[model samples]
Target chain A: MGVRIQMPLSLRERIGMEEMVEVEGDTVGRCLEDLTRKWPELKGELLDPNGRLLLRWTIYLNGRPPSSSEELEQYVSEGDIITLLPLVDGG
Target chain B: MEREIPGGYNGRILRVDLSRERIDQVDLDASLCRRLLGGAGFIAYFLLKELPQGTDPFGPENKLVFASGPLTGIPLGGCARHTVGAKSPLTGGIAKSEAGESWGPQLKRAGFDALIVEGRAHRPVYLWIHDGDAEIRDASSLWGKETRETQEKIREEVGEARASLAMIGPGGENLVRYACIMHGCFDAAGRGGLGAVMGSKNLKAVAVRGDRMPPLKDPQAVKRMAAWLKDHMDLVKAFSDYGTGSPMPRFEQVGNLPVRNFRDGGFPQVERITPQTIKGTIRVGMKGCFACPVQCKKEVEFREPYHVDRIYGGPEYETLAALGSACGIDDLKAISKGSERCNAYSIDTISTGMSIAFAMECFENGLLTLEDTGGLELRFGNAEAMLEMIERIARREGLGALLAEGTVRAAQRIGKGTEAYAMHVKGQELPMHEPRLSKALGLGYMVNPHGADHMDSMIDLFFSAFTAQPTVAVPDLIPLGMEPAPLDDIGPRKVALFKAFQAKRIVADSLVLCHFLPYSFSQVAEITSAVTGWETTPMEQIRVSERILTLCRLFNLREGITDEADRLPERFFYPTQDGPLAHRSLSPDEMERAKRYYYRLLGWDDRGVPTPERLEELGISELEG
Candidate 1:
């Protein structure tokens, strides 16, 4: 079973999905790697060419941030909900 | 004009009589100029000496004062902000607020410290200022356009892209009750619907480009202030790095950021939309406003087509709250889109979003129907629906037209118990903070001369008392730092003291300091002394700040507002689902006690009016005349 990786509110339109983003990976990094592999539209939305998570993006594994020790495969379950949030700001 | 190259000002105030189609210049009294600084201070003097009473807010008699303070046009964390004060069309009272960077400093250096536009224009007109000279030119060509277009048009007309433009949109022209006055294309004087006031005057926009530097009293003083400011480079970095969104987690974690229009502020989606989320998703590069070091204004781009797949202003916390979860929209893209529309249409995001939220709640509760919405579901969380509504509101079309009247009025129209859900305090929608979580902020909203605004005196950040502290989920989450003043210890006296202090600091910040400077009193005091000769003693500074607050109160009072207006929305007064503060509010007894304490401390009568004694204390005894 794979996990679902969703784009944040700000980038959801470009990626074309608000939720249920299916991806294959075993760690947070791999999950993102898989996420970009499928929804290539969001590559620049979340990371630079080097694949570093942009300063404004944060990830949640099953409603909570993944534990430091847990890799993508360590916690990958069929129905895991991985949410991506962006920090778009101005008043 | 009196020229004092260093002490405080550039020595000139620009005045435009739209009815006469003439622009005049005057010198600001130097001694009073230093003490008052800029922005609100200048507005105060203008209101007293020039903008006489009996003048209609919309008629040719009203005055608009835009001034940058002594500390403006400098390279500080708090960049210079221009102030706009005139009799408010929304509340039918005096309204004064700070419009940020791009316009204020340039207007000041162009050889004028203040710009006062008075009288109604004979035709659609925009002001063009080059250096000290300003002219009210025919803007018929500029009519029937949006703010962004107006900016571009003015740029082409003036032949300078560097010029500053503050304009209104169709919403303003139609006189939407909560329209905004947008400057620098992003920032705004978003409350009191000042844009509507501008529209009523048939004023189109004011564009300025100047080539002059400020006259510092002491170059060493300027250098020392700059050096001292450099010492706090870490905070400066943090603020710039995060822009104002850094506070998203703090407010969300603390339960301060209002969600659902102060209805249940704890959005399960908070973590997803935090500043970290913004930084990772759409931020392309760091952007600054004018000469600001802590460039908090972000230019966010939404790629691809959804609702807001274009370039425009990014979403600040207030905008996110206003357009996001407040209306059940969790998508960051939609929030950014909403912010952009507000700027494009020149309307207040807080009010417009709340207006939509108000509509959503009514429809969801079955109080409103599809027929009422003219086929649009008007459902919460519908991004497409929101986009249509924003356009409609700006054009005053269909359901959008109904909502453009504002939440308070719309709720009243939608009957069937919708009033209970209307999230307005004194006809203005609550701006993005759940005051129940923060009593100081609650009190600030209660006492804010302009309806429920967090900008006036957001003491909630420092005191940290009333912020939402989720006890069960995050056990280590304590709302405040080590030593926070408690509600009782911070009785009405201390609360008033804190409120007054924050108001003064706000006056300074609103005029000069960046809203995100986030300094303690000691830091602000140090900066104020180094730049200008005005020394803010611990006690005296706090009191003087309180005095400035009282002046705002007096301005409102003179314009016919009173104690009954000091209020939190009835919704915030009760609990939908209690987490932190519980189902507790200031009981009628407690509220009375707090009000009495505040009144006594300020020497005001129980009615919240400034007593004659209070005016005398502030050396404005003649204001009663």
Candidate 2:
């Protein structure tokens, strides 16, 4: 139920992330939480201090946004692609 | 500090009467510029006092005033933004303070504080100003030319290599309600149909080249402030290199953008049409206004050198948003093409794009068909279809005629439940900032005088990204008790203080300083002290800006949009359907609590009119006295 997560271009540059991060969690949110936990320094910039996700950019479960944060809890099948698209500002 | 000057201010207000074929220049009075800070401020005041009410927006009774602030010709931040004010053919208001650096610096260099244009012409004409000499010249040959061509022709005719020109294209000539005036082929006094005002007067362009620069107070101090701004290259680099279009990717990810007429927040192919797209396709150098260090403008040069990439001002965030996601066209090329079309026709790109998007939505809903659209299937993401509509609208041929009138009136004319789909505030198309995500921006838009503009108050952003208190404003009511709250963060007090601070900071841009630079307090103080030698502080400097705001507020009042107009659009109260803000809406009852508190903070009555005491205290519109 664990999958590899890829950091967004913006987040990668900010956190000096590797090509793909190894995360073990049942859901996308869980995976992200695990990723944040492993990359502790990346927490504030990616998630709000209260741990709520910053909505400024997009985080896709596979190729699109997951319906809910809880949707990440769904067991991740192998080869699922999670793309992080964090934009600094929206025009 | 009192230096005796010889002919510093070419203090003459030029008036062109096309119907009478007479041109006159009046002497500049100190009180005029003093009361209205010279640019949009002066124009707004003049329009309120001189132009008669109830006259048709297109009639000769209305006049157009193009002005630059005191810092225009100065070498400070290249902030020479001009103001164009008149009865809006689009919004039917007394003024829309639109500007571009080209018109302003040129006016100041031409040795004039401002240009006041009046009366409609019997035929086409353009104004030619060369170093204090201005005349109404025949523009019959350039009548049908686009903005760039007309400018080239005028420059050629005048035999001047470097001249700042303001011109309208086919859109304005056709009297499109949202027609804008273009300067430097990229910048525009874009909203409220000022170009149409110029067209109605039969004035095609205003070309100016001046030999002198305005005298600044305390040159040494000015230089120091300029140097401080110069050292902060990071801030300047943020805008200049990426241009404002850098936000496209973020907006897509955030779900704050309107993809296909507010139906969706993100575009499927948005990456293919962002600043990165341009970076990958062409070599673009940074561009800027005359005195601006932060050149958020882009100049892309194509190796093949097609007509499109020959080099022009880059489209900013608003243009990208309007022409891209708003219309469901994710192709950067088409968005750039639409921007080029706007420059050619001198129309507001935001309104034009929004109008077309609304039309497309209408088509999808079966309100418009191929027959109605001349056999074009107006579906979302059709770049060619978008191009066809823009060209047609600019030309005022076929369906273009109806769309040229702007989104609000067009929606009303079309009827069929399309009004709800037309995204506008107080009859003006909404600018970029999705208010649900950035509530402060939305509140700013709600209270903006030119109809729901975000620049009026943009603090919601700091709160969203930086501050601890997330959603704080009085939400529309004044003084639950007789006395207002303290100025601290206790309850509604912080909201009141924030509003006043925002108003002051924004209004200083009336002096034409780029808001990006953190130089307002120091340079504004130096300039004030140098000019009048008043011992000024940051707080006092803002009060001077507030004085100008008082006049603008009065103009809005005279234009018949009062405190009642200070409400946001209804759509914002309901949560959005796309993105993270889908379930969130700023409720009216909530807004009422905050706005009422704002009115009380400004010392206004329950109706939100500026109190007589407040007016006297702020020295509102002192010139009329």
Candidate 3:
């Protein structure tokens, strides 16, 4: 099933101008991988050299932020909304 | 004013009396410096001692103190921070707003640690300081000028291109309750309407130019810290690249960015006005404060619907959310223009936007109409109307006059049960962040003396123990006992953490350091000891913070702010209507408990007043005198 992937204004330049993109996968990680597969230019921005999700972003699955980046492999069902958000420490 | 001092300070305090047109210089005692350090700490000491109980905030008797910390003027990233403090005209309580730019460093180099301004001038004037010399100059020509124009005229009159100015604009001259004291074209001590205080005194601005450098006690250690900061550039590069608005997406995702005057959770047009989009569209360059590596200020230029000037500066995250999402406007160009207008008028963007949002909501509810708006349609998503309202507020024309008084006063003036819709805490409008999404922030809004200030304490989401999901740990906070707790729980652990972090924030503001800078508690303590030679530690720093907070609370209590006043708006009690956080609201009982627990933690009595024993422990028993 397809999940809706949303990007912030800051990421749209690198990931294209679209606010939300649709991708098919079973888990959060798989959907993200599929997202990168379609937009290869965004792979480095989302993941580090070691294939770990960058801590600079808080990947929210259906409006719920993961407790840790390790949970990126959590199951993602159809119609889920995935939002990529930057982590800001201070104003 | 020159005197020999230890490594960190210049050892001078400049005092100005507008009524007498007098200027006095006094040597700052070493004992005082050791006890209070500087910046907000010094402000708290002076305000508690010099100001009597129930002093009018805008009257001639009230005093405004401009202070800088020991680390200010040092060659380090985020070192150029300074603080402007006084009895808040908005909250009628103690208030301090910090600004980072060249002005603080210039003041330090001019041989002054602080400037205390009192009395009211018979005519418009500006205070000028250069080297160790100071004077009161006529500013009749600058009385009604915009902030940028006033800065230009002051610099030209002083004949120093490098001279820095802290000035008010038309908003201050007109006495807008939320007018801000602006520096250069962008940086501002933006809260509590201290600029209106400046207006009440007939003081237009303070300009300083200097070339002297203070001797450091441990230059090598300072250099090492600077090097450490440079090496850790990655910690703040994102801020420099995106300014503060880069995190808009994250805030929106969690329903932190209040849309349509807090009626909605998230904005559908967030992407159009985010930092990335603004950068790609109208951003020309990035700007930095004094000795700062993190250039977290955007320089934007737009020549479309409106001729947005880059000289007025671009919007920060709060500005974006306030003028953009909060108003239901997505046009980046319009938001940029609104930001420039606010800067030109020297009004606080948060209060200005939130005021407009309040008005727009009233309009939607049929409390106001186009006839009431002076023939302008005051509705959500009307970018043109919003832009017009900004200019009108600056000029104080018709409807603008009421709105310029700020949301609290405006709501009172329009009393048809409109107070419920006025989003304020202690008379000051809330910042862009919605407290429902972050409960700790809600607590902060309730307890902050300055009113709804997000920077006063730790935000909930940033807590080390935010959630059970692999939490991101900040090793630096471990010493202060900050760990992740449930994001929404106001449990004892969470309350304890909140109290601890609240102390830390006071320390940061007193030090006058940018909160964005990655300075650990230990690092801050080490740096303080190295710079001031007082042999400080994290524990001592926290103690000093508690003293400052207690003194401020005393000042507020003197202003009649009691337990009944220490509450949030009714809007915060009800569940959010829509967003990722829909149906989430703070428990009134738990909030009351947290407030009581926090008061107890700080050694204050049940009514939130510091006990005599606690005052003795804080070395401020004499304050009761």
RMSD of each: 10.2, 7.4, 7.1
On DockQ, the stronger of 1 and 3 is 3
Fraction of native A-B contacts kept, per candidate: 0.11, 0.07, 0.06
Name model 1 segments beyond 4 Å from true. A1-91, B1-6, B48-55, B247-250, B307-311, B459-484, B487-490, B509-511, B534-540, B578-586
Query: How would you order the candidates by TM-score, starting with the best?
Result: 3, 2, 1
Task: Summarize candidate 2's per-residue lDDT along B351-454 as a digit string, tens digits.
Answer: 88888888898999998888889998888778788889888888887778888888778888889887877777667788767766654455566666577564
What lDDT score goes with residue B604 in model 1?
A: 84
Superposed by TM-score, candidate 3 places the C-alpha of residue A70 at a distance from the truth, in angstroms, of 18
- The docking category that best describes candidate 1 is incorrect
CAPRI rating of model 3: incorrect
Please state the error at residue B136 of candidate 1 in Å. 1.6
Weakest 10 consecutive residues of candidate 2 chain B by summed lDDT: B473-482
**Share of the reference A-B contacts seen in candidate 2:** 0.07
> How does model 2 do on interface RMSD, in angstroms?
7.8
lDDT of 3 by residue, B1-625 (tens): 2234667788899999999999999988766665677888899889989998888888998999999988888888878999999888888888889998799999999989999999999999999999998999999989999988899899999999899999999998888888899988899899999888999899999999988877878878988999988866645656766778565665676677889888788576788888878777899998899988888899999787678788887999888889999999998888899999899989999999999999999999988787889988899999999999998888889889999888888889998988988999898888988887667777788888778888876676554232234233344666667765554677766677777777777887787777888777899888887887768888888888888888888788877887777788888877767777687887889889888887898899888989999999988888874
lDDT of 1 by residue, B1-625 (tens): 2235334467787888888887788877775554456676667656755656566777778887777777777656565677787777666666776777478778866888888888888789888988878887788987878777888889998999889888888878878878888886687888888888788779989888887866554567666656765664433454466566554554554456666556664566665665557777876656667765666666677656654423355776778778887787777777787788888888888888888888888888898889888898888888778778888888899888788888778877777888887887677778776666556666767776767777764443333222232111111111111133453333544464555545555556434666555454555555566655556543455555555567667777776678888776777667645434446454545555666677677778888877887788777676564
